[model samples]
Target: LLTVIVTAAGLVSSELRSGSAALTLAKPISRAAFVVGKLSAYLLHLLAATVLGTALCVGATAILFGAAPLGDLLQAVALWLVYVLLLTCFIVLLSCTLRSQLGVAALGIATFIALSALSLLQPLAQTPVGMADVVTAAMAGTAFSATWPLVTSAALALVLLATALLVFQRKEI
Candidate 1:
């Protein structure tokens, strides 16, 4: 979240706040391309960081524990990637509307927590049943069900990005 906020939203917000946006626009770059390019760069950075962080964590765990949980690690990595992508698009969208980095960061955090809580509703709804029931249900939830969070995150991210692009296209530099 911090990675996406600082890299994507922070950079753009700072550029806009410092009046460099006008200078950059004075060149021939279209606003769409500029926003997309900035987002792409941040995503690339995020991808590299995620891969490197995962490698180091797995490597360290293997060295200390003799074996690493590759399956669980991969699952976690997939979820985290979806989360980061979703948040990155969200920050970009928020940054366009909110001039303050602090405001964007605060809203991003709130958005993440809200979305996460919503996602956990499925498990919580079944909680009154018992722990065993929850675990069993989760296990039996099917592959798609198990990966529902990732799918939802991806969908939301796409929507947010599309909206951001539309807003950015009409926004004055």
Candidate 2:
């Protein structure tokens, strides 16, 4: 993701801002194909990072922590991949909308902050109820609070990615 922002946003935006879209057009490529090629390159770049990161994480778990139960480990990893796809979709959508490094950085930070807040909301809300009260109540009824935030986040990401694809296809640049 960082590499893409550095290479694509910085490098690509420089070309767009300087009216170099014509240079790309001179290659006898359709505008849609050109932009799609750029997006696909960045997509591949992110895929490399994610694949390497996952491998390193699993390797570290085995080397440093020792191999544990494979079932739970795989389950955790599968869940993580779902969230990662959600994130990648969001980043790609934002890249289409802003096409600027700074804009992408700001949006990424804001999205992370918002998601973190949502994830932490239960504890934050229960603070006023006292820890003991929360624990007692949680033990009595349910251990989990609202899961709507996660559902919403996933839905929003899918919607945004779909919208971005449409917008990017029609975009003149």
TM-score of each model, paired residue for residue? 0.80, 0.58
**32, model 2: CA deviation in Å?**
4.9
Q: Which stretches of candidate 2 lie over 4 Å from their true place?
A: 1-15, 18-22, 25-40, 122-155
Q: Whole-model Cα lDDT per candidate?
A: 0.67, 0.55
Please report how far candidate 1 places residue 171 from its true position, in Å.
1.5
Tell me the tens digit of each residue's lDDT in model 1 across 61-82.
Answer: 8899989657756765665566
lDDT of 2 by residue, 1-173 (tens): 24433444433344455667668767878755655566667666766776787688779888999985555444444444445445555665666666576776567657655654554456443222122223233334535332443454467656866776676666667
What's the C-alpha lDDT at position 59 in model 2? 90
- Model 1 clash pairs are none
Cand. 2 Cα-lDDT:
0.55
lDDT of 1 at 22: 81
On TM-score, the candidate that comes out on top is 1
Candidate 1 error regions (>4 Å): 123-144
